[model samples]
Target: MAVIANAKVETLPEPWSGAIRSGRHQLITDKPESFGGQDQGLAPYDLICSGLISCTMITLRMYAQHKGIDLGAFQVEADFCTNKEGREWIERRVHFQSPPDEALQHKVLDICSKTPVTKTLLRSLEINTQLV
Candidate 1:
């Protein structure tokens, strides 16, 4: 497995505005003005969802290509909600421009659940923090 350890984020003067760096790419993150941010870019939850969605789609595409399966255009929508119980649930809807067979659809669904981000989210996280 490839490791990504160089990702970093720096806070800007604006509240909740962060400059994120990953390799040669950079992105901005901020919350809505109602949450005391400038609303410049995706919030934390949106970034998480984006990771999961991107991973899922990439995994499926690789699998289909490797297996010589003709998976046409597709789209995925994911929603995240947390309740009083502190439980977070992510609901995802996937649609294909040309629907595949039931077997292929099931295979794709299975692969989506196994995406790196999806698996990581489902498993317990062990974070060790330190101040340099």
Candidate 2:
């Protein structure tokens, strides 16, 4: 397995009061002002939660396909909370929309729990963070 120790990301301002990223691909992020965002560039917290969910789902899908157990094409909603201490602190919750058979569902969840990104967040989390 190839491990991405660090991914370098680039960001730029949108043409009209927004923000985006440019690389091999392009993405845009914006939110309403009520969420403490400038209403620009994906709200940072939402982006983080999305990362958690996407990686987990990727792993789960691959595993299920390999085992010949189709998860039946579902969506996962993921949200996370920052702990009392730091960014290194988090609570990841993934909700699968499709209700599959018990055995299939559990296996999908289990597969998510083992993805490299999930494992990194849970196990290899040692960082120097200072909250101002």
In TM-score terms, which candidate is top? 1
Can you tell me which runs of candidate 2 are displaced by over 4 Å?
1-22, 29-32, 82-98, 126-132
Residue 110, model 2: lDDT of: 77
Alpha-carbon lDDT of model 2: 0.64
The residue-by-residue lDDT of candidate 1 on 1-132, one tens digit each, is: 566547789999998999999999999999999998999999999988888888888888999899998798998878888999999989887889999998888888899888888999999988889999
Tens digits of per-residue lDDT, candidate 2, 1-132, equal 564544333444533234444445445566556754456555656777778778877887788778886666666666565556765555655555667778776776677778777777677566675865
- The stretch of ten residues in a row with the least summed lDDT in candidate 1 is 1-10
**In model 2, how large is the Cα lDDT of residue 117?**
71
Deviation from native of the Cα of residue 107 in model 2, angstroms: 1.7
Candidate 1 runs further than 4 Å off: none
Instruction: Please give the distance, in angstroms, between residue 10's alpha carbon in candidate 2 and its true position after superposition.
Output: 5.6
